[model samples]
Target: MNTPLRRLATITLVMFVALMGSATWVQFFQAESLNTDGRNVRTLYREHGNARGPIVAGGEAIATSVPVDDPFGYQRTYSQGDLYSAVTGFYSIANSRSQLELAENDQLTGRSDQLFFTRIRDLLTGKRPEGAAVETTILPAAQQAARNGLGAQHGAVVALEPATGRILALVSTPGFDPNVLAVHSTSEAAAQYRALDQADGNPLRPNTHQERYAPGSTFKLVTAAAALESGDYQADTPVPSPDQLTLPQTSATIGNFGGGSCGGEQVSLADALRTSCNTAFASLGMTLGEDVLREQSERFGFLDPDLAVPMPVVESVFPSDLDQAVLAQSAIGQRDVQASPLQMAMVASAIANGGRLMTPYLVETVRAADLTIVSQTDPEPYSDAVSSATASALTQMMVGVVDSGTGKAARIAGVQVAGKTGTAQTVEGQPPHAWFTAFAPADAPRVAVAVIVENGGNLGNEATGGAVAAPIARAVIEAVLAS
Candidate 1:
């Protein structure tokens, strides 16, 4: 053969090999990701055409897929739309999915690997595969109580069963109705989503875990835990309780919430905690130094940027590089310290569960269409935030808060409640945020709850955590106890 002809043949051979390799990459490696992308019209049509499973809570379907005559074949519906929107989230063609709808999309759409045997059986029998039902850990009554507790306010409530880390209730007020976003018409759904996304107070976002704010006095729980865990201080250890003290190196003067002495010039750590004394904690925090404080905070799940309850939880952060003044302010739950209601609930849960911090979880079980259990969530401990002895001491101090201190509004009849109240001042001129975190039956805690009322509810700047946020925490605690 001529040299030029042989060269031409070699060039053609190389071109053919390259074409085959490209085709193989698209057919194998990129297949799953491209197929699963929500923006893929074919994938959307396929998922919407099938009968998706219902998401159950308290033995009732909170989210279901109903038949539709359109090409989509089904439309998702949330029975208690706004109440469970933060949990079930919305399954929409336009805006896609979130929360459980996003996390369990495979199982809900009957595509999970766990359903392989079922799919095989269906294929052999020439029958259609059915989606699996996701049973959530939510308690309807507790959820309702949380909703009513934060009624008309812009805030969030998170309740967890300490022993199991099962999220019982998660409520974010100024909630949007998920049904609006689940409509069959793509245009209508997109428009509704845009409206909610643009609404005041950000109704579309889940504030309970997705947003963070200064925890106010609710964070005293962490500081107290740190003090007790240090082995250098006991609950009754005498600490400074002056009414006012200037933060070190800065002219900023920190005082008690109402400008009164905590107890006296010097009081026990327990007494300072009961009173939610800013000066006491600030002084302690400064002494403990930023490294110790940050370690304690991170142990309770702060600074964990990717923490999630099966859904993304915004990082609850404690300021990193801090001087004495900044540490003092952060100790009082001010300065750069910010936390989500979910993180606060975890703090309370860690104390309630004997210092073993359980990993927060939402879904309890996943069952096939035939009611056969396919997957279940096992309870896991996230960390040992404090020793059992420290937890006990902190619990006693919190009990005193409910019994005779600022958290009195959280008291329940015939039940011992351990709680802390916080009134966090925001930027100049804005109302302080109200906060309350608690666990019930002090000796045998069954529930740990955190409630935050932004802009101080109806009382404006005069609202204190005990006056505004504690009552809400009480209601939720009672609901869980009663159930």
Candidate 2:
């Protein structure tokens, strides 16, 4: 062959090999990402045409796809639309998926590896494919109670079964209706989501698991845990209880809430905790230093980069590399310390579960269209935040809070309740956030919960965790116990 012809043939071969390699990479390595892309209209249409499964909670179908006469073939519907919107999250063709809808999409779309047999059977029988049913661990009564308790407040609530890490009830106020996003019209659905997205409170976002807030005095639990774990302090250990504590290197003075003294010049750790004394905890936090506090906080699941209750949980933060004054403030859950209601619920759960933090979970079981269980979530221990002895001491201290302290509003008639209340100041002119966390039947806990009422629950600056959030928590605990 001529030299020019030989060179042309070699170049052509190289081009052919490059084309094949590119095709293989796209077909294999990038296949999953491409298929799951929210903007992929083809995939969206395919999922919409098929019969997606129902998401069942407490024997009720919270989310279901019903038969339709339109090109989509099915329309998604949420029975308790706004009530369960935080957990059941809307499925929309306009925006991407979220919550359970996004987390278990593969199973719901009949494309999960566990559903391989179901897919094969459908293919062989020439029957249209159907997705699996996702059964959640939510308790219907508890969920409803949480919703009713929050009422018109702008905040979030989360309840958990300590032993199993099963989420009992998750709620976020100023909630949006998922049905609006599930409308068959793509243009309409997009418009609805956009309206919610641009709204003032960001109602489309679930504050229970997604948004973070200053934990306030409720985070005193973490400081107490750290002190106890350091082997240097006990519940009755005497700590400073001055009306005001002078922060190091600064003229700033940290005083007890409302400037009330936490008793004598020196107070027992137990009394300080019960009183939610800002000065006492602030002194303790500075003494323990930033390292120990952060360590204990992490043990209770703070600063975790990735956490999922099957759905993603935004990390609770404990700021690192702080000076003495900032650390003192952070000790009381301030100065850049932030947490989600779910994270606070985990903290309470750890204490209730004998210091063993169980990994939080939502979906309990995934069943095929034939009602055969495909997968199940087993109880898993996430971490050990403290010793059994420390937990016992802390429980007693918390019980004291409910009996006579700021947490009195959380007390139940027949049940022994242990809890903490927090009123965290936000900006200079804005109202503080109210917080409450508790576990019931003190000695034998069945439920642990966290409640947050933003902007003082309509009490203006006077709103407090005891006056605003604790009573709501009590109602939820009562509902769970009754059920």
Q: Judged by lDDT against the true structure, how good is candidate 2?
A: 0.93
Q: Model 1: runs farther than 4 Å from truth?
A: 1-11
TM-score of each: 0.97, 0.98
Backbone clashes, each candidate:
0, 0
lDDT of 2 by residue, 324-383 (tens): 999999999988999999999999999999999999999999999989999999999999
Write one digit per residue (lDDT tens) for candidate 1, span 1-483: 699999999999999999999999988999999888888878878898888999999999999998888888889999989999889889998888988999899999999999999889888998866799999999999999999988898999999999989999999988978999988788999999889888989987898999999998888888888888889999899998788998777787998877998879899999999988899999999888888889999999999988878899999999988888888889989989999999999999999999999999999999998899999999999999999999999999999999999999999989999999999989999999999999988999999999999989888888999999999999999999999
The C-alpha lDDT values of all candidates are 0.92, 0.93
User: Which runs of model 2 end up more than 4 angstroms from their true locations?
Assistant: none
In candidate 1, residue 144 scores what lDDT? 99
Query: What is the clash count of model 1?
Result: 0
Residue 51 of model 2, lDDT score: 93
